[model samples]
Target: MKIDWAALGSVFGISLLITVALVALFTLGIVGLSRRERAAAQGDTAAVAVTGAYACFAACAAAVGYGIYLIVA
Candidate 1:
């Protein structure tokens, strides 16, 4: 039996980076929402926060969809 150490390591590294990035994005989205709640009392800032949060969420969804597509196709 033969093992491809290099390819295995590459896959592991890529997966780790992607997982970390997604987590960071999600965390940012949560933080943005929290900010929005606080900023609501101050006006326009809440709108910016809401927009940023939604953008982060959208990127996360896109990443998940792309991962699913890669697995299925």
Candidate 2:
């Protein structure tokens, strides 16, 4: 059997890109939470930061769910 090198490379590249993007999204969420905590300690409210962090987390969850659905179906 012959290996389809081009198809294999394409899949590898897309997987790597998605992995990096997901990690970055999760990292931003963590940073946002830290910023919110810091602001609260200084007697200030960082509503935007908290909201953005939750949004990031939601996006990550959605992506993961979609991937699972694809595999199961």
* TM-score to true structure, per model: 0.91, 0.97
Model 2 C-alpha lDDT versus the unseen true structure? 0.96
> Candidate 2 has which clashing residue pairs, if any?
none
All models: lDDT? 0.92, 0.96
- Which one wins on lDDT? 2
Task: Point out where model 1 deviates above 4 Å.
Answer: 41-45
Task: Indicate the TM-score of model 1.
Answer: 0.91
lDDT of 2 by residue, 1-73 (tens): 9999999999999999999999999999999999999999999999999999999999999999999999999
- Scored against the true structure, residue 26 in model 2 reaches a CA lDDT of 92
- What value does the lDDT take at residue 19 in candidate 1? 98
Taking every candidate in turn, the Cα RMSD to the unseen true structure, in Å, is 1.4, 0.5
lDDT of 2 at 16: 96
